[model samples]
Target: MSRLRPEAGILPPVSSPIAQQASFGERLRALRQARKMTLQQASKETGVAQSTLSKMENNQLSPTFNLMQKLALGLGIDMPQLFAPVHEARISGRRSVTKKQQGREHLTATYEHELLATELDSKRMVPFKSRVRARHLDEFGGWVRHEGEELLLVLEGDVLVYTEEYEPLPLSEGDSTYFDSTMGHAVVSVSKDDALVLWVCVAQ
Candidate 1:
């Protein structure tokens, strides 16, 4: 990871107050409305059931990380955009700074994610810090697959990376790997303590 100098005026602090205040249901509805998409349409696009989408939009249901990923991909938006407001204008020299442990959090059964640079829309890459909480492959509902490429760097403890096409690989702190995002994959902590990792995914 490259360190940015705080004194550099080129980097601006990014905050998502709207995301922090609104429920996922509200945000989802807003996005759908903005795009003039119906729940049935969203269901078809996301591969999620219409009843599930309706329940989610009504705050009667909460989506898992995998489901959220599907939603983001179907909506043609980044995962962070599902939580924050979208800015459509294109700008040059854009940069954001997220202080330690200050990124927007998105929790799941197997991983706790701190989504970084979330205030910026139309990002080419999505960066986050995550804690591996699952201890076994069975903890995940299924393998996670999505568009683009991914890079994972272990920050603390140990983890086992499992992919559809390869044997599980163990990684320790400071170890990193890059792989195609389209391949189904999941990660679990192998250490007593949950492992932490920096994950960056290229937007496809």
Candidate 2:
């Protein structure tokens, strides 16, 4: 899919005092509609109940990691797609902090990320919770871009994501964005507070 161009005058990064207002549930619904699939079709494919799917789409249910896998597989997407970033109203900086409980393995010193699903290694979709401290550019220095597109949901603070084509995508709480890492990109938190984000890197 092609990317939408960033709007003029970088949007001031979003700042939110409250968390859990993100559209995680709405994104799932958007994907389902975009694919022209019905709830029954997905439920049948995943062997899950139709009512369960409804609750999920309605944002009434918080899905477990295992259940997330089933939904992603049924939708012909990798597990990370469920939380993939969506282009938002262009904004420069956004702020919101979220503390997540993730798997221990994917956590890095500079960036603490919980692995949503191990299938990322093979499925080419790696989902992680990224926590970046201020002035922590070099912390991500160890990162090596392998392949795929990266999506981020800014949980808190400001992240300056630099790529080749355009300037950094500064995202904040409730904001989301996507980028291809082939051109070499890095995420830096310019905010005084810690920058927390959810990243889904997909290699297609």
Candidate 3:
């Protein structure tokens, strides 16, 4: 599939304060306090703006996918740890399989994700199935950049991927893309049909 260029400076939509005040905010604040680090100090370490950190801690703002990845690095934890409701000590030889309706599913602004292998702890990778919702870079708010690498496979319909360094790439069902997550990126459904994708990210 050919790639297309998009207009610059797209960002994600903001979440309501009430919705932002969920367990994620509490947990993020708790993690910072536990380290006795002020938001300013943490921001320096994480490369996130101090004001943004404050908003996140106070549940006044919600993070983007790349921001979450940055927070995970700042907290010295994997991305899945940020998503986990409770921590579980890593156990060896753990195995799990989930049916179509069995995995833990949640909706963010950009996608509906079903987390895979939640039973395991300290995993080297996080795997999930996501339904793409946004149809353009404008809907994404902005390009997304994080750490590590990611693999995205189109499961249902055609998808268009945008990155900072590359033109938008279009993929039909069964096509896949693998790249460094640190490069700013976003995905949209370009076809009239719905889009489902399998996304996997390695732990940093």
TM-score, each model?
A: 0.83, 0.45, 0.77
Which candidate leads in TM-score? 1
**72-159 in candidate 3: lDDT tens per residue?**
7887766655545545555667787878856655555677667787656566888889888877666655556667899999999999
Which ranking of candidates, highest TM-score first?
1, 3, 2
Query: What are the per-residue Cα lDDT tens digits for candidate 1 across 1-204?
Result: 122211100111123442345577788988888889889898898998898888777765656555777898889887889877887877899989999988877666678778899899878888999989999987776677767899999999999998877889999999999999877788999999999999998856
Q: What local distance difference test score does each model get? A: 0.79, 0.58, 0.72
Evaluated at residue 148, the lDDT of candidate 3 is: 83
Higher-ranked by TM-score: 1 or 3: 1
Cα error, residue 101 of model 3, in Å, equals 4.5
Per residue, candidate 2 scores C-alpha lDDT tens digits across 1-204 of: 123231111111124211133444576788778888788877788766888777666655555433565677677765655664433344545333334463422223345446565323234556677777535444443333434577888888877876657766777687888876555555778888778888777655
The 10-residue segment with the lowest total lDDT in model 1: 4-13
Give me the candidate number with maximum lDDT. 1
Candidate 2 residue-wise lDDT at 138: 47
